[model samples]
Target: MGSLSRHWPRIAVTLIPLVFALLHATGALHLGVLQRLDDIIYDARLRATMPRTLDERIVIVDIDEKSLDEIGHWPWGRNRVAEMVDELFDRQQASVLGFDVVFAEADESSGLKRLRQLAQAELKDQPGFVERLNQMQASLDYDALLAKSLQKRPVVLGYYFTGETQAKGVLPAPVMRRSELQGRPIRFIGWSGYGANIEQLATQAPMAGFFNPVVDSDGVLRAIPLLSEYKGEYYEALSLAMYRLLVGLPEVAPGFPREKFFGSRSYGGLESVLLRHPKGTVAIPVDDKVSSLVPFRGAGGVSGGSYRYVSAADVIGRRLPPGSLKDKIILVGTTAQGLLDLRATPVGEAYPGVEAHANVISGLLDGKVLFRPDYAVGYDAVVLLLAGLTLAFTLPLLSATRAVLASAAVIAALVSLNVYLYSAEGLVLPLAAALVMCITAFALNMSYGYFVESRSKRELANLFGTYVPPELVDEMVKDPEAYSMKAANKELTVMFCDMRGFTKMSERMEPTQLQELLNAVFNRLTDIISSNRGTIDKYMGDCVMAFWGAPVDIPHHAPLAVKAAIEMAGAVRQINEEHRAKGIPEIGIGIGLNTGTMCVGDMGSENRRAYTVIGDAVNLGSRLEGLSKAYGVEIVASETTRKQAPDFAWQELDRVRVKGKEQAVAIYRPLAPAAGLERPLLDELKAWGAFLRAYRAQDWEQSDVLMLNLQRMNAKKYLYELYSERVASMRLLPFDPEWDGATNFETK
Candidate 1:
């Protein structure tokens, strides 16, 4: 049986995978149940982990070909642009400015173009003399004044980085290097692009960021490259430059964890962003491109929202607010019809390309991005260990019904807990493994109970000859192992009850009438038993047998059994009252209860079986029911039951060894008095107990005293003389100390 019970748990464990697969195939379980809720939680979590705001920002002053065509031709002459910058700094007091454009060649104004021709002619016949004379002349540097103007103030220039192997254009020097992140040396590859600024002017800007948008597999710009090292030095992106200016954090903290040069975080090889401060170093979370998730407050869609397009024409014209450009870092990008600066982002397909930088700057300022690490094995191991160990202990002691219920509850609890940790605690523990364990146990146990164990229960029921309660057979089917033939000592509440003079009722009634009447009374009693979750052991002809705290360890089984008894007596009384009104014969039943340790299990032969309890308690319960008539009450219980059930209302009836025995036992009736007796009859029962106690102690004076009062109060009461006679006899020789409530049986 031990082996079988162990196997029962395995049966539940084995079949779950099959059921889960079936459910999965049908699409019954999915995250869609709470997709909206999960989104909100994840979004809020991501929002709280990014930077607060942007600083030292440079606004791109777009000198699009449109402004060029409106003024004149392609090169709008460095003189005009130089004049604009001079007015911006001197009059408007603009703190900083950056150009998204570059100049690789020297500016050739109309005057210089004419001077070169005249110089070449001066040495026309002189051969090498023409080159010598032309070189000697001081050629006009058109952008020279513009370079000086930009150099005197703070300005940052735009540059880019690439991995084209063969350089496509000019590349910038590295600012973020491998030594800063990795303990080892680093290597980088880059491309060359056209630079339009004059070399002297390019040196004027203090910092710069390569404006290269990194897109993920879905073609969304979710993250950006914060650092990309080349050879041994790392360079910063436009967003990073702005962040450093904002926070004033040292580029490198004193001691920091070094990652390998190849790949450190989820942002591919160069995705991680490490910044140093007094407290500790903080890693800005990014995807493969060292970019963070964009927080789009609205659906900016394919066409990005309008930026605060501050016109350069207005600022130079003094057509702006007084302190608008005083201390602000402005990015000047084009919104003119043809110049495109838009790209797709996670929240918007057509987000402004420059807005990606703005979003990153916002993230760094707001601190709302979440980072998932590459090394998350520790969290997974903990979850797996907890789930596996808990299931091991939980599956063994539980029956099929309880096991399945607990498994469902555990799975739901784990899911809720994990979701909370993920959202609130920033924890990313394994959810799959624990979920699998719960689903596996429930699916296996239920399928086994329904298909396998239930069939056994029906068979066990079929084998129990005249076992009475057929539902016990069904209950056994749910967990046949719970009904094993081997018995263990268990404290139980046993109830034995029988209909009074059922044989006499069979005499006058026709067979059909008897069947109908028995069915009605039996149905009422069965209702009471099941309503209180008590097991009906069987029905012996017109008698009902039941026991509690078996098959299932109900903590309050005693109370439940007592409650069922009280209810059963009331139901029978209600039926009797209806019968009396209809001029039918009244019926009555006697109920007895006892609580003690006993052995309960399957009994009888292989071909026939019985699920019943047996012990001295069982015999006593039957005796008490038989003595109920002598005590003139419907329900009687032993003192053992009355003690454990002190919360219930009870009336003591007698100390009697009924019919065929010596020794005595105290018997009491649970008087739901309105249900079992008339108001006067209850007074008579109390008066009777008063008389019986005296009789047992040989107090004839007290017994006779109570008998005289009882006869006066109610002459219709029965059993007074029975106790009076016993009192007379006990007084002659007295009872022995070895006496108990033992009744000698004349017949089996």
Candidate 2:
């Protein structure tokens, strides 16, 4: 049962990872951190497996530095664009031409509108008359020329949508209308405003697509919407519209899974985007939001060789080979730094925006678009559950090395399987949640084993650090398994010390000053006992209760207790000398020591417990401390302690039946170190012992003579003077025949 109890923490921490896994499985929690990490992992795998070769099916007519140098900067005149359009189809013989640019505003850079306004207001009568004006009107109207060039051509114009309230320019007919969706369950991204080509240019172009890329919170272009809805009408993306035109103008429709496939749910969103044409049905992959992951075909444009790029200036100037763009899907866009058409993608940071559309076009043509199905959540949850449970049960049963190796194998398997699904099956599945759970479970187990399971040393420190000396505690900690604080009867030494006149001293000083003085006295007295290797049980007011043995055994507790009592008496005198010099009140203390078998251990109520001793021996020690005032001595000890420490000079204080005790016990005062005392003091001690014998024997006259000699040698020795008065008073009273010279302390 004890061994089983130690494993409880390991079992509890293991359930933590399982809880997270369960929450994720139930869709009650969405770990966005894990999702983002999985996104990064998917990107790395995508980049590692991408075919880094050029696709000659699509070519970009880049308005590069060379083109800008020759063509005189951006927003070029309409006639210049018209000339490039003619150059691509008529001269270069391109199969299809798409504009990755917008013609939202009229091309007023031609100065044609200004010239007409001037002709109507100021220069109406100044030109070569109406004939010359009419002839220059046809030549200067560049918008008309550009519009005519676009008429009846396979040109796909690009535009963008905005979150603004007001729409801009003219939008073409939508591919699908809201009325067509009628009750069908499908989700489409909605927009508030759009920027399309002007009326003439839009009507003249064969088709147009909004080239806006949907950026994520982390500012990465990962997924794009093939179709978006605005004002109850649906518009196609630049890539989607271009793919449609390339595939013989397929009709756009929403594809849905069978009703049996979705079960009880009201809607399952879009399953795929259908491209219906004369040949058959071509299903383009799309998620619930009708968005597809951008299948990046390596880094494209000028830096990487994913697509061939030709300068628009060279094409317009007829400087390139005749069939340079022959039968190629030509996309007209800018690679100039000033255009700001670069984007952050999986392959590179400054990925060409035009090349992004090209990759989508190629992906749709090749049917290689990645899909994240509705069942991906279920798939991830199952993996997380299995991995978490496996690690939870396995780690605790194995050693550290084997546990780590097992965790590594689990993580490697998960990653390998996820990557295989991504590369071979074109599936986008989550991987981070399960991997993090496995690693976290393993770490929790290892940390618990290292810190909590191996805690014997900490237990020892906790038990003895507060009571015993630091050196003793250090030694006990080294062999903690051999000791415990359990109550038991053990022969030990216990001491109690209390300050005399503390109540009156406290009344004379401020509270703070009294507290500081008390702290100084106790700190000094405690150091004396601690230096002698005694365990301090507690400090109660101005008194200190301490015991030696039990918490850690000491074979010679009696001598240690006696030695500590002697030092405590000397320490009080030294303290008083320092206090008298500082004009502070001096203090004094009385200590009592005893040696006997007593019960000792951690004892108290449930609210608080203290590692201490309790029994008759401990109580007698406290009573003896109180008797020190009556005996006129600094220290009082039981005869048991006096007999054990023979190296100390002893003065028999009394034989008394203390309160709550029937037996009369002999008590004595420890005078000083026997080796250091002079012969005169020894002679005084001899005279005092003889006086005690005579007084107890009822020989009052002889006892009086002995006490008088003791007082004459030391006139300030009030104890002998006290005995002289007692002997005189006893002579007048009737003596009992049963009297044994044992005093009875009835009040305690």
Candidate 3:
């Protein structure tokens, strides 16, 4: 609970994108950019996966520029079109033939109507002219000739639906009636008017279909409605008609989803269009509008090579060998630019509209049509939920590198799943929401971590950076909430290091020189203190105060403080050596260390605040520094500090009562690490220990013997000499039973 409260801000920022994504998925908000990106993704996937190889089963008889130039312009005399149809059926042996062009009006290029008018008015007196016109009418009526050629043949005529209410010519029989839908409220592409074949040709080829494609908002013709409604009748597309003719003209019916899978409620759409034949039923999947995405084979046009292109002039002029198009499904359409048959498609911007129909026909025969099922919206919601929530909760907890990798993996999984459905199951599912949500979540999470959370860290660094080592600051920033300036009681080690003989050095040197020298000396001592993870409390003129285990916790703080004091003393020694080389006055430092419970935090007046420690232990530490001069040692440590640092060898200086305290406390001076103690020092320490025991026991003779031996070992050592004089003074007095052997200091 505490951790969550601490990191709530970061987690909330990570969820911002997720909230927007959920709104988009649930239709509460619409993101047009995501839609556009989805379209691009779908187009690219379609283009990349298209089969560019030739489909020989479907062929396009292109009415290109060559055909127009060789056989005059389009809407050529119906007699010429009749002759071309005869050549394809009688000579080429095509199994099924369909026209992508509509014969909406009668062909009058034979001049038979003008001749009839002349016989009626201008040449009424010429009886022989009227009779000759009647005889040639049968041969000149081009519409009749084309109708005769189309009869009793496997032919499917093409037409188009329009949004305008003015119908022209006559529409063919609808594949399905409104009564067949059983009031399911399926939404079919609706049209109010149409341009179909004239009655004369319609009777000959009554079976026909509309070729109206569904253009997307981006003006790309990627799908075609297999069934469009006009006056309560559902008509089929040209591609669907051709496929039906090739498969024995199966009966069409509405295909509803099974109730077990989609529940009993209305799905608001048709699942598929079923083609029922004697053998089996073929199901063609449809989207909400009863449309199917055209599976483009590849780029379009004659040079595209996805479908074989035969020029109409060649077939009409008998340029190809007979039976060459045997068993091939031929579609007659124009690819000439003047015909305005080019369309924008996924694979090509200027794709032949005829090739789109051809590709649909090919896909229908192979059962590879793509569609979005009714549950696609639900699928999108589920995906977005999973992806968004996963990133929202997990990204805030992960490191930067892991978060990036996790976000990448989620995006890859979404893309792979979407592509697999498209390729293997022919399902066109929504992916943009999930992908955008993941990327946005990761970016937002990282940004918040860097900007907002890092601002908190920077503030922490600014507050305590000067008082503690940068390494300790780094540790503190990892969980900045865990640290603060609020005062709290904690067991810590405090240090007070005072420079000795600073007054004498100041008197002998220039003010600037003295300042420079002091700064140099303090800089060295501060470095030593910081290197050992000590938090410097303050510097009081000739003294520097530091501690361990505040703002950040250190379990072995006592040892660290002791270690830093020893190093500080050594630094002062080195500085004094440099002073000696330069003929400057030598200096010294006295360090005191104590470990106990103290109040540690940012403390002081509002105008001048500092992160420092205060308590009895801190005061005792200061008094220990003063006692270091009396003991003639560079470092002094309280008994509590000595007890914590067992690895260091210590010499007990005295048990003394300072000015403020009535209770006496034991103090010791650190010599060196226990492992590094020399044989002579160890022997002297042994002798000094015996002297302390004898002096405390008031055995003057024994104390004298031990002190003489200690002085002989190190005659010039001040601590041994001071203890000798103390024992002499005490020996002159009577052996008093009330004496506790604790020395007292009247002043600090």
Candidate 2, after superposition: displacement of residue 358 in Å? 0.6
What value of lDDT does candidate 2 attain over all alpha carbons? 0.84
- Model 1 lDDT tens row, 430-536: 45544664676556544554465546755666654234345545555666566655677888888888988668878988989988998889888887887676667
The TM-score of candidate 1 is 0.42
Best by TM-score: 3
Q: Tell me, what's the RMSD of every candidate?
A: 33.5, 32.4, 36.2
Query: Count of backbone clashes for each model?
Result: 53, 0, 0
lDDT of each: 0.60, 0.84, 0.88
Total backbone clashes of candidate 1, pairs 3 or more residues apart or in separate chains:
53
Question: What digit string (tens of lDDT, one per residue) describes model 2 on residues 1-748?
Answer: 4543567678679769868865865579877777788778878988988898888999999989899898888878888999989988888888888889998888877677777777788878884845676788877888898999999998899999988887777887799876666567577888899888888888889599988887876788888899998888888998898888888988998877544331314446777789898899998878777888888878766868888998888888889887778889988888888989988988888888888888888898888999886567667777887888778777777788999999999999999999888888788877878877888888888877443223766677777788788888776765677777788899999999999867988889999989998998999999988888899899999999998875778888888889989889999999899988998878778898999989988899999999889999999999999898887888999999998888789989779999999999999998887888999889988988898898888888888788888888888876776777788789997866788999899977
Task: Name the regions of candidate 3 deviating beyond 4 angstroms.
Answer: 1-5, 259-266, 452-748
In the range 1-748, model 3's lDDT, one tens digit per residue, is: 5666677787788778878877886679999888888888899999899989999998899899999999999888889889889999999999899999999988888899899899999998986999888889999999999999999999999999999987878888889999999988888989989999999999999889898899997889989999999999999999999999989889999999755332323476788999999999999989989999999998899999899999999999999999999989999998899999899998888899989999889999888989888777677877887887778777777889999999999899899999998999998888887887888788778877453367877898998888888999888887788988999999999988898788998888899988998898888888888899988888889889999988789989988888888878877788778888989888877888899999988788979998889999999999999989898999889999999998899999989998789999999998778876899989888888888889889999999998889889988999888888888888899989888779999888
Question: If scored against the real structure, what TM-score would every candidate get?
Answer: 0.42, 0.59, 0.60
